[model samples]
Target: MFIDVVPNRGSPPAVLLRESYRDENGRTQKRTLANLSKLPGDVIEMLKALLNGGALIGTAPKDLAIERSLPHGHVAAVLGTIRKISLDRLILSTAKDAASRRFCDLVVAMMVDRLITPRSKLGFVRAVDEETAATSLGNLLRLGKVKDHEPYEALDWLLERQERIENGLARRHLKDGILVLYDVSSSYFEGHCCPLAQFGHSRDHRSDRLQIVYGLLCTRDGLPIAIEVFEGNAADPTTLKSQVDKLKARFGIKRVVLIGDRGMITSARIRDDLKTSSLDWITCLRAPQIQALAQGDGPLQLSLFDERDLAEISSPDFPGERLIMCRNRDLAMERARKREALLKATERELARVQANVRRKGSTLRSAAEIGLAVGEVVNAKKVAKHFALDIRDGHFSWSRKIEQIAAEAKLDGIYVIRTSVPKGELSAQNAVQAYKDLSRVERAFRSLKTVDLEIRPIRHWNANRVRAHVFLCMLAYHVEWHLRQRLAPLLFHDTELDRGRAARISPVASTEPSASARSKKAIKRNANGDPVHSFAGLIDHLGTMTRNIMRMPQAKKHPFTLLSKSTPLQDQAFKLLDLDPMRVQ
Candidate 1:
């Protein structure tokens, strides 16, 4: 028997219970069992349940309860991807001991939290207990009901296997002859107890606070391979030698080209360390070096830019090395605009000082004080070279050094990259491209510091914990890189093809309606007619696919979990990642 709704014109639909039977001649005949609308609500529901193959003895309305509702969809998706990569297995294989496996799970859990909702290590236990109920991580890793100290202890265990874990990652994602981008960044500390924490150049602009320096090594595409932490006082150039040794000795990478910013590795160090070790490198020149290249009769003079934006030349100062000089018109324009703004600001500040000197009733300041005031104005603008300041008779006057300004302006938007890779092996254009890829390491640092993983405010005082914390954040970044690559169609990723030379592609302007109009009209497609969403929006979309727990009354039956139906877009995302959305089951 089935309950069928009968349509009636200009009236509410009629609900009918219909049953079918075969007559003696094998012809079908139907009869009305009952009118469901006329029956009691409970009776009608029971009949509906029986017809739909539901349990007849379901809990009564008053006895039903919701055990808990969790935000399980996003966590499940991340964990599914994590398992597909066999990250947990790779980590566990380092040590077969039970404690090691548990610690591995703890690390994985921390990484997931880092990606989803970052919090302090002490707060992670509560986050997992509340937010990750649908993931099997707790059961698989045996991290149920974590103690506050377990995460720290697990970090200690994980730190012991850092080399092994890094080796595994290198084997998986790295290969010989790949361009590896490296850079260093410092994270400030909340308290200075760690031996590695000391006063250094704080990249986060927290110079007043102590910091710890860490270097990240990643592929040209920004997939992090290894991370190394050092004392806060370690110099950027000083860290390169150890990393080169690790690449050669530990990872066995023989033919890789290391790309770094000029601040990280000087020309001298490249000559001394990389040349002797037979390792190739690509790095840009400092401003003074670029100026020297622009000196009289040099190959990198300003006249070279008139013919082309890039040129390959050999310099006598750097024998047997190729220098790729590039000048960007847009960069030049930007620099010119910035210098004008700074000059104006400095003029206004100097005018204020000059007014004080000319005022009749002003305090009688000494010549030294007036000189100091003039110095402060020029220094603050950082354009002292372009200005000539005069202090005489407790008065000040200044004028623009037109020749100096013109000379400095001649070098705007110009940069030179020095590389040892032979022209036949790597062309000058590719060398420029490779040196520019140092921005990928910069991107990684941005993600680590401000974006997904906030690897700052180093609360861990112990050296081991600091290292482990950085390692955990890097691991999380590895996962994030894969996700972003798969989700590139929805993100503003660098998708231009390399055609053996550099090509600048302007972003295609969206012709879609304004955001306000789109919101009112419920528009979700981009100008390309593809679905448009920010990374966070996509995550929130997938998060709609949740796990629901339904339970009977207290002291009755145990609760059962059911997954919410996935939308087409959510299913597509899972398919792209090759993940099973229902893997939690």
Candidate 2:
């Protein structure tokens, strides 16, 4: 709102009022009051001096609120706790500039939501319109503030934060030893120029792109502790032992039971890594590969397996194997039915082939050959074939095909679990249970891919930003994981992921960033009596309240008190972090 005291055509300025006050020397002083609140305080103060208007400003608290109106309420939920870890702030604020703080606040906003990156962060921070944002972003880029490659640096920041949390956790909960679940997977990037991208075994049908190896070490409760990036062409088996070694070296964890999928690590490497290293491991092996071990009656007994998920064992120096009983009667029947169906399919194909041959005036020549080819499609046009039937194509009967399928299916489904733990240290049944516990890693991966930090296409090109980007994503995951560990049971027992993360975030916002936007327009009359208006938009910033904030800290001039002026966003952040919601209310 503007005052009507000033008329058109800036011929002369209208005086608002007059006042007298005692000077610092206790002398009486006369002053002319002017309406300078419409402009920024700094600008108004400067204008008063240029025109010799003796401090035409409201120094009194009651009169200073010239711009007050509605309440711009904000809520800060979780940023309070995150601040205690000061090292993290230093890393993200690497540049120590306008851009760095802006990026950091935006990232903190994500951490508030629990994580984002070039591709991921780009999805958020969308402005009022695409063009406006794009222009602002382009300017930011020119200023070296916001770039496409920022997320990768964020990834590094993520790892660093993980270390902090790990150290913090050990300092707090020593009894609940950390459960480390390990796993390996590959992600392919479709770019020839990508140095780390290469073609290797892909879990997804993405052989066309260069595939990179990734190994994750997650907690039993599904929180990621470490994630390593490898060259695209690297093999999983070769890296497993080294990662295990790295885990020990970095965290100095000796009491960890490394649970892993059978395919993640080789048996030979397991022995090489864990035999001397103070660690216990549980892994499942392919039964058919170890068929001799399965069929033997001396070492391990299958029938002795007390329960379905339970197993019994008795082996040697390293440990023993568990023969889990197949108690799933329904699964057993399904397996049998599946075998029967295969047999039928084979037999039908063989019969169709024989019929086609007979119609074409071809003879089986003999019963032995015909029997061998039965249930197999010898001729391509006779019937669709699923597998090889001992006999050649175009001459089998439906029965032989069915027999072959049934034979194959009969030997297909079974499970064998292996352990390197000693009999005294860990029982066979315990080993089996331990392997089940290993599934914690998979759950952690699920949260990484879905629940919290869904960092996929990793759009950052500059390595540091990319690292920083993924780092925050990881940090968010860590925060939520801890939140759930500490608060899930307390607040929600049956909540699925969608509801959990939504409710777990610390509801918070900082008010300083929006200060410029909250200002009224500054107007000035031109020589022709035309009014010119100017206003600045949002400028992001961040600050934290200190424990010794009770004492007023003096700036270069006099003692300053920020007590009355509240940074509303900071208030919300404190509330979200489960800290005090207000600053000394």
* Per-model CA lDDT versus the true structure: 0.79, 0.47
Which runs in model 2 stand beyond 4 Å of their true positions? Answer: 1-118, 121-178, 276-278, 296-302, 305-309, 316-414, 423-430, 450-452, 460-472, 485-585
Clashes in candidate 1: how many? 0
Top model by TM-score, which number?
A: 1
TM-score of 2: 0.55
Writing each residue's lDDT as its tens digit, candidate 2 over 198-235 gives: 68887656777665667776665566655666666787
How do all models score by TM-score?
A: 0.85, 0.55
How much lDDT does candidate 1 score? 0.79
Q: Point out the worst 10-residue segment of candidate 1 by lDDT.
A: 505-514
Task: Provide backbone clash counts, one per model.
Answer: 0, 67
